[model samples]
Target: MKPTFIKKGIGFAIASVIAGGSYAETTESPVSKNQQPNVVLIFVDDIGYADMGFQNLRDDIVTPNMDKVAKDGVVFSAGYVTGSVCGPSRAGLVTGRYQQRFGYHDNIGPRVRDKNVEQGLDLSVKTFGNYFQDAGYTTGYIGKSHDGDDKKFWPHNRGFDEFYGFNNGAADYFISGRNVENSEESAHSSIHRNDEVIENFDGYLTDIFGDESVDFIDRHKDSPFFLYVPFNASHGPMQAKHSDLQKFAHISDPLRRKSVAMTYNMDVNVGKIVNKLEQHELMENTMIIFMSDNGGKPDNNGSINSPLRSTKGTTWEGGIRVPFAISYRGHVPANQVIDDPVVSLDILPTTLAIAGIEEKEEWELEGVNLMPRMTGKVDKLESRYLYWLTAARSAIRDENWKLVVPNIHVQNPRYELYKISEDISESNDLSSQYPEQVERLKTEFERWNEYNEDSRWGWNKDRYPYTNGWRGRE
Candidate 1:
C-alpha cells in the first residue's frame, strides 16, 4: 500500500508552504561559524500546547516570558516529542534517538529498593551534556533530573559539570519527601547541589531553579556554557505559592486556579533568567530553546490542550505535539512560525550544528539538523517517518497521514487514521475509507518496531489498567 498520488502531492504542497517556498528561492542565513553561542535548553514538565500565552488557545493564562520567547524566535506549529510521556520523551531529546531503541519505552516508576533495575536513561548512550562537555562547554543542569537516581545514572556522571534538583519523576513543591513506601528514608526528593542534598530550601522550587540558573549564567558568562533547566513546576502534587494563588483568585475552578498560579510563577522565573542574560550581554550569543517535555495530563494537572485530541500519555496530537520555539537574538529570525513537523530529538542535532560540531558517525543521531531548513537554506526537509510506542498502544506518522493502534483492552480497540494536515484536532477517522493507507502505516510501524529493543521495564498493570489507556477525549 502507498499514499495516493493526490495525497502525496498535498503533503508536498503543505511541506513547501511550511518551508516558506519552493527550492528555487532562498533567504539570508542567520548562523555564524566563528562565534560559538552558549546553549540554554529550558524544558518544562507536562505543559500543554494551549497553556502558553503565545499559543493563543487560552485567553485566561498569562505567560509573558514564554510569549516573548516565541516573539523573538521561530515557533514550530507542528512541534512534537518522541514520546507522549516524560521519561521517554526526555530520553529521545538528550540522545537524539528514539527511546524505544534503548528499551526506555515507559515511564521509570518510583525507585524500588530491593529489585536491581536500570530505571534511568541507559548508561550506554551519551547525552547532550556529554557531547557539549567534550566540545569544551561548561555543562550544568538545574531542576528536575528525572532521568535516574542510581549513582552511575546521576547527571554529574552523565557529563554535566554541576547538578541541582531531584532525580525522581515528581516532587512536592513546598517540601521534599520520597513517595515510595517501606524504602530507606532520606532526603530523596530534596534539592541537591552536586552530590550534597540541601534540606529545607527557602523558596518555591521553580523560583529556586530560576535563581540558580541566573547564577549559573553569571558564573559562566565569561565562557561558553550548556545549561539545561527542566522545571517541575506544574507536574503533580499541585502546590502553588500563596502570593501566586492570590493573583489567580478570579479562576473559579480550584485545580485550574492552582495550575495557573504555578504557570505564572514559572513565567516570572523565566523572565528572571532572560533579564540575567541581557544584563550579562549573553542574550545575543545564547541560543535559547524552550519546550515542554510532553503535553499535559489534564486530568491530573488541570492543563488544557485546546483544539487537539487526547492528552499526556497518548499518541494524539495533544500528547506528542507541544509548544516549541528557539531564540538566538542575532541568528534566528524573530516572530516566524514554521509549520513543519519538528521533534524534540532535533534539539540535540540542531544545537550541535549551531555549536560548529560535525555529526560524528558514532553518535548515530536519528534527528536531523534543522538549521538549514530553519534558516531558509533548504526549502523542505527530506520526508521521514515518526513512530511512538508504549505498552498499551503504538502510532506511526508519515508526512500528513497518522495511524494509531490501541491495545485490545482499550475501550476503542481499533486502528485510527487521520490526515493530520487537514484535521489537527483528529476529530475524523478515515481508516475505514482508507484501508490501504492504514496497512502502509501499520507496516511502517512494524518495521520500525523491529529496530526497537523490548522495554527493559514493563508498566505495572495493577496500577494502570489497560482499560484506562489515556484519560483524554479523542
Candidate 2:
C-alpha cells in the first residue's frame, strides 16, 4: 500500500516544467525557533468546492474573507478529507488517524439522550484539545458538532478547557424554541455554553459562533491558545438573516439566494476573527487554518461544486476533495499552491511539527506532517495512497490516479477510474479503456481496505436511532 516514486503525483508535472527538471524540499521557512504561535482552525460544514471566490468556479457566489485567506495562504489544489460525509471526516481530522482505524465510518446522528444509541467520538482517541492542552495551551471549541450528543463526548471533557456550541448536526440560525422535538431540546439540539443550555444572542448562529471564537481569542491572546471553530454554516434547514438576505436579493433562485446569504454571513464572521487577530497584534504569531468538513450537498443545500462531478455523500471529487488553506505569516509562504495530493489527516501532524512538538508513534497517527512539504523541506509524503471506505461507498487515490467504488446499493455497481489531474470534473469513466489500471487499483484498494473497519451504526450498521441517523438514499 506504500506509495513510492514509481507512482508520480502532481509533483512530477510541476517538476517537468520547473528549471531543474526535478523537485525537492527547497523552500526555506521564515519562522523562528523561539516562538510558539497561536493555532486557530476554522472548520466549515457543507461548503461547496466552487463556492469560494478563491476557487473561482462560479460568478454568483462571493466569499471575501475565505478568498483573502487563500490569497494570503497556501492553497492545496488536491486537498482531501477522510470521508465524503460529516462524522467520519471529522473523526479522522480530529484524531489524525483514519476514522476506520477506530471503526467510525458512518454519520452519528443527533441522539445524545438515547441510551440505546452509542454515539459520539470515541473517548479513547485524543483530539486537538488533548494535544494542545497537554502542551500548556488554553483550548476552546466553538461551533456545530457531529461528534456526539452525549455529555462525555462534549468538548470540555475531551481536552478543551472551554466549550460553546450545539450537540447535533444542524440548528436554526435565528430561533431555537419550537414545538418540534428536535428544536430547543437542551440535551440534544439547543445551543450550549460550556455544558448548559443557553439562548443564542440576537444574531444568527454563524455570527454567534464567530463572536464566541473572537471572544475566545481575545481572552486567550495573552497566553498560547488553540481554538477550534467548526461552523455549521450553509448546511441543511437553510435559513438566513434579513440583513444578509437583502444583500443577495439579486440572486433570482430562492434556494441559492438563501445559501449564498448564509455563506456570506459565515464569511463576515471569518473576517471578524481575522480583524481580532490583527487588533491584538497576533496575526503573524497566530497560525490560522481554514477548510470544510466535507464537500457540499446540493440536494440538501443549494451548494454548487462545479467541475467536481457530483455532490456530497458519494466518493467523487466533489464529495471528498475540498478547499484547504493555511496562513502562518513567516512560517508558511502566502499565495503558494501545493498540487500534490494531501488530506485532512495531515493537519494534526502539521500542527505538532510547527509548534515544536514531536508526534509520538504511540499515538499511531496515520497523517504525515505537511509543514515540511509546504516549506520545501520535503518534496512528497511517504503515504502513496489516500483511502476512503465505508459499507456502501469507497475510493482509493494515488496522485492523479483515482479508482472509485460507487455505492454498493446502486442497481449495478461498477468500478470507476479517472486521471483526476486531467479530468477535474471526473466526467469521463476510464474503467473500460484502462481495465488493467482498474484491476491493479482495485486489487491494491482491497489489500488496503482489509485493515479498515465497517460503518459504526448508520445505513448497513446494526444500531440505529430514531432521527438524524443515516437513511440510505433512495
Candidate 3:
C-alpha cells in the first residue's frame, strides 16, 4: 500500500489551511476494510523514577522529548516492572505472564564463552509478536534481545518477521566487532540485518537504532506493523559521545553526568522516532508505549530514585517502579495520569487486545488488558495479588501493603512490612503494629508461589539461597 499526496486546486486555500505546513500532505494506504493499528513499543533499559521530566524529577536532566510523549498520552505514576532486574523483567513483558511461571526468575545463566549455549526468551511460550504476526502484522524487533538459554528463543524464532539487534546480554556502544555476533551479514557495533551478523558502522548506538526504527516505520507505513525498539541506554558501562556529555559537565559525579547526558540522547532519539511517525500521518493510527525494563543502577549509572528506597536489584519501590506512558492519538486520553497499580507484563495482553488478537483460550496469560482502565472504562483496576522474587529475595505487594524480605542471598532473617501508600520509599515498617496484615500477606505470597512450578528453580546454590535474604543484615 502506498500513500498519495493531493495537489492544490480550486479548494487549495482550505486544504493548505488544514495542512498548516508544506509537508501537511494527506496520504492513504489501502486497508482491508479492517486493519489493526501499528504498534511501537519503546522499551528503555534501567531508568529510575526521577529520570524523566514527566515524572516530576528534581534533577537537571533534560528529557523534553520523553516528557512530550507523557504529555500527549497517559502516564502511569505507579508502574512496576515484574522483576527488579533486566532479564526476568523482559521475560515478564514479552510473554504477558509472570516470569516465575516459566522458571525465568533470574538473569540468563552464567555468561561463558565456548559454552556452546545461547540464552534467551523461553522457547515454549508464545510472545506478543507471535500473536501480532499470526494476525498478519509485520513485526520488527530493533534492539536489545535478552531472553535465555537457546538460539531458537531469539526474536526471529519468537515470531518477529524482522530482527535487527544484539542477542547477547550487553555490548559496548562503541567497538561492536568485539561484542556482537549475528546470524546474518555483520555491521559495526555489530549490525545484523536479520539473523546474520553484518559489518559494524561508526555512529552512536542510540542514533543508529533511532534511524533504523524510523526507516522501519516508513517502510511499513502502509501495512500494520509492530515495532519493538528496546534501547540499551542509561545502563551499565556508561558511554556517551563527547558532545552529549558536555551538557552535564557541571555534575561532579562523572558516572551520573554521563548517565544524565545519555538520557538526554535517549530523549532526543525518542523525539526523532515520534516526529517521523507524525510526519508520515501514522501517529493517529499508531500506539506508542514508553517504559523501562526495570529501575536504575544508581551506583553505576548515576541515577537517583529519590523518594524511592534502595536502587536496582532490590525490591524497594525505587527498584521496580519506573516511568511508563502510552500514546495513541485520539484513542487514548491526553495528558492524563493513572495511579492504578500496573506492571510491564500487562503490555502483551493489552497490546494484543488492541490489535484484536484473541488469546482467551490461553491459560498462561496472567496479565489483564490495561487499555480499559486507561480509557476510563473502569473505575479502578481489579484487586489482584502481585509477587516478585529475584536474587533470592521475595516481595509481595497487595493493595496498599507490601512485605519485603531483604538480603535473600544471606543468612539471618530480617523482614519489613511497609504500607506503601503511607511510605512509598518503604521507610516505616508496620509489621509489628499489624501482625495480622503481615500474616495475611505472607499467606497470599505462599499461595501464589504454590501455583508456579519452580520460582526457585535455580536457587539450589548456597551463595544465593532463597531464605538467605529473608533475614536482615547484621
Determine which window of 10 residues in candidate 1 has minimal summed lDDT.
9-18
Candidate 2's residue-wise lDDT over 1-474, tens digit each?
222112122211110111211112232233344558789998998988877767765777667776766667778878899998888888898889899876787777433223344666778899978998999889999987776656798889999899888867777777544413443343555677777767434667888888898899778877788899999898978999897789789999888998898888887888888877766777778888888888998878899876687878889988988888888887777777788888998899888887777889899988888888777778765658899886478888887689988875678778888887677777777888889989888889889778875445564323433334422222
lDDT of each: 0.78, 0.77, 0.74
Candidate 3 error regions (>4 Å): 1-34, 111-119, 176-190, 408-412, 455-474
TM-score of each: 0.86, 0.86, 0.86
Superposed by TM-score, candidate 3 places the C-alpha of residue 439 at a distance from the truth, in angstroms, of 0.6
What would the per-residue lDDT of candidate 3 be over residues 1-474, giving only the tens digit for each residue? 111222111100011111111222344553343567889999998888778777765557677776766777888877888998888888888888888876677776543212232334557788888888989999999988876324477788898998888765565677544434432322223456665765656688888788889789878877899999999887766999898888678888888888888888887888778777777777777889999888887887888887678888888887898988888878888878887778887888888888887867654788779888888899789997778988577898876889998866557657788877556777678778889988898899888988764443233444333332211221
Model 1, residue 101: distance off in Å is 0.7
Best-to-worst order by lDDT is 1, 2, 3
User: Which segments of candidate 2 are over 4 A away from where they belong?
Assistant: 1-35, 109-117, 176-186, 379-383, 409-413, 460-474
Ten consecutive residues with minimal summed lDDT in candidate 3?
9-18
Can you write out model 1's per-residue Cα lDDT over 138-205, one digit (the tens) per residue? 99999987665565788889999999887777877866333222123534466778777664546778
Worst 10 residues of 2 by lDDT: 11-20
